[model samples]
Target: MRIAFASGKGGTGKTTVAVNLAVSAVRVGLGTAYVDCDVEEPNGHIYLEPEKDLSLPVAVEVPEIDESLCTVCGECGRICEFNAIAVLGDRVMVFPELCHGCGGCFLVCPVDAMKRSGRLVGRVETGVSKIAPCGEDRTAPGGEGEISFVQGILKVKEAMPLPVIREVKKHIPDRDIVIIDCPPGNSCPMVESVRGADRVILVTEPTPFGLNDLEIALKTVREMDIPVDIIMNRCDPDAELPAGAFDDGGARVIARIPESREIAEINSRGGLASLESPEFARIIDKILEKILRAAREARR
Candidate 1:
């Protein structure tokens, strides 16, 4: 089963839920593989320090001008949909960052001077986490004992995330449950990560901002025709739309993690919050059960 955890906005604890859920799934011997689709800022590896067995360089095709071809009719620049190419007098400059690799510029180049060049976009690292030498469980929250797998990381300042996200998702095992830690946003990256997912767990807090973004994310998921479940992280009884509200909406309230200093302390220490907090772990387990139930029903 491929499940993706995403939020409409950042800092809403999507990663926290995703990482924990993967660990929980692995704990039950599901052979879960967690893919950090948040390529822009992949923090999942920080929690589960998997060894780097294979590192494949990811590149994107960008327009490269061959100045020797001469005729700078400026047609390439004019035809570029992304404005990635610019022609100044007799000089043609290619701004790779602006290029979307559509190949339109090269196709439109009258002189056939524009060609495709590979520019480094990011890389995918595959490996498994070796049990710590001390015999302690090193896997993050959801990883109860120890598990190993592959992880992808997008180079900083890389604007394109969908390609890398797709590449990483391709590595997911057929029988293994895959949990994608999506980038925090309702943009292309998040969309790509959530696409074709069996279920999406939208994690959020109880604040007004969290509620607002959650609604937006819910709308997005509905539009995509993807089943969604809500998990209210840091839920406070005093906050609006208490636990029952989420359940009332058709989407189950699988987990309600109360706000606590322990969460902060563990996060500060770069440790999995669910691993240190039994309450948090239980909440994650409930979400996992709901996910499995939904999966089984769909199969039937």
Candidate 2:
């Protein structure tokens, strides 16, 4: 099943949930792949360390203007909704960044002065992790097996993230459980990453800002008609948002990871909390159980 771990804002622990879920899934002998859809800041590889096996460049089409096509009537410029085409007296210029590949400028050009051209957006890298010893399957909750990991990384400074995210998702295995580490914020990139997945796990904290963004993300996912569950990371009893809020809103509360100094230390050291804390690992296993159960029900 394809599951996407996303959040409305940054530092809400989406990647933390995604990586731990992937590691847990792998522990059960489930051939799994983790796609880091956060192309702008892909840190999923930092934990999994998948070997770079394949790299593919992703490109997007933009408008290119032909200067020799006679008069700059401004027709093409006016027709472009993205403001990609501009008329400068007798010359017409096309801004590649502004172009959305809608081809409106090309269609409106009387002399066919506008043409489609490609620009490199980003690249996708595929890598597999070396098999690690089975140290009592911490992800399955009373289960045991060896774990294998795989990850995808997008090239840095890539503005268009959807293309790279789509390419990374293409590597998901049929029988394996797939977890996508989606980019933060409820934008096009986040939408593309979670689209058509079996389920989505929204990770957030217990603060007002977290609740506000969580509401935005909930709306986005509801509009997409996808099922979502909540995981309150760094949960505190005295927090502003209650744990039952998600359940009351018609979504399940899969897990609640309490705030801990040990977790902070492990996070500072760039390590997975589940790897450092066995208690947190159990919580991840419970989350995985919910995911697995949901996947099974969908298939039936």
Candidate 3:
């Protein structure tokens, strides 16, 4: 099962929920992997601390123009919908950033002036890391069994996170389970992260901002034809979950975590949030149970 933990916006404890759930899965001896798809600001490494096993650069192919070729034909420019290649006067300028690496310009060029070259964007790192002990499983070995971890670190000032995100996901093993820590928001990055998951866990708070964005997030997931459930973070006692939050979205709340200062303090100290709070641990267990059940049903 590829479970993706995502949210409507940032700072709703998305990573906190993802890392904890993945750790819990590892404790149960499930062959698990965690992919931090939040390329722009991947933070799961801060928790998993996986030993670096391999690192590789990820790039996209863009058209490289050979000025020596005779014809400055406008064919390449017309075929490129991205406008990556522009023919002006007698010069053909290729914009690497705007290129989608489709290599259309190269294919359209009759004189073979256009060629494909790698435009380095980001790097993908894969490693192995053990989940920290949660105390619930006293017999569970610590640092004895490790789960695979992979993350994509977007190059600074790069705009294309989707390519890097796709490369990182390619590392997901064909196995029992994998948790994806997705980037926040209902935008393209979030969409790319949660695109093909067995289930998407939408983490949100109870505040008005949280509720509003939750609706948007649900819509995004629903459009992708994926089933999603909520993991309410900082479940405020005074604030009620919006009644119509899931109105037509087909999403429901699967777990709720009330505000806890202890969790906050532990997180601040770089400690695991879910393991430290058994209350939260129970909630995550429920989440895991739900995911496990869904996977079983899918197999049948």
TM-score of 2: 0.86
123-197: candidate 3 lDDT, tens digit per residue: 999998865643455454443356789999999999889889989988877657889999988888899889889
Rank the candidate models, highest TM-score first.
3, 2, 1
Off by over 4 Å in 1: 73-75, 88-91, 130-148, 237-250
What is candidate 2's lDDT per residue for 1-300, written digit by digit as tens? 788888898998888788877766767667667778888888877777666777777776777777787388899778888777778987988888766566677778799877778887777777676433345533444333332333434446545667667777776555467778889999998998899787888998878888888988988998999998888889874444555445456676677888888877876667877767888878887888888888888788
| Cα lDDT, all candidates | 0.76, 0.75, 0.83
- Per-residue lDDT tens digits for candidate 1, residues 73-130, read 8888888878787789879898999877777877777788877799888888777653
Candidate number achieving the greatest TM-score relative to the actual structure: 3
For each candidate in turn, the TM-score is: 0.85, 0.86, 0.91
Tell me how far the alpha carbon of residue 43 in candidate 1 is from the true structure, in angstroms, after superposition.
1.0
Worst 10 residues of 1 by lDDT: 130-139
- How close to the true structure is residue 15 of candidate 1, measured as C-alpha lDDT? 79
Q: Pick by lDDT: which candidate is best?
A: 3
Shift in Å, residue 254, candidate 3: 0.4
How many clashing pairs in candidate 2?
Answer: 1
- What clash count goes with each model? 4, 1, 0
Clash-forming residue pairs, model 1: 23-142, 23-143, 24-142, 129-148
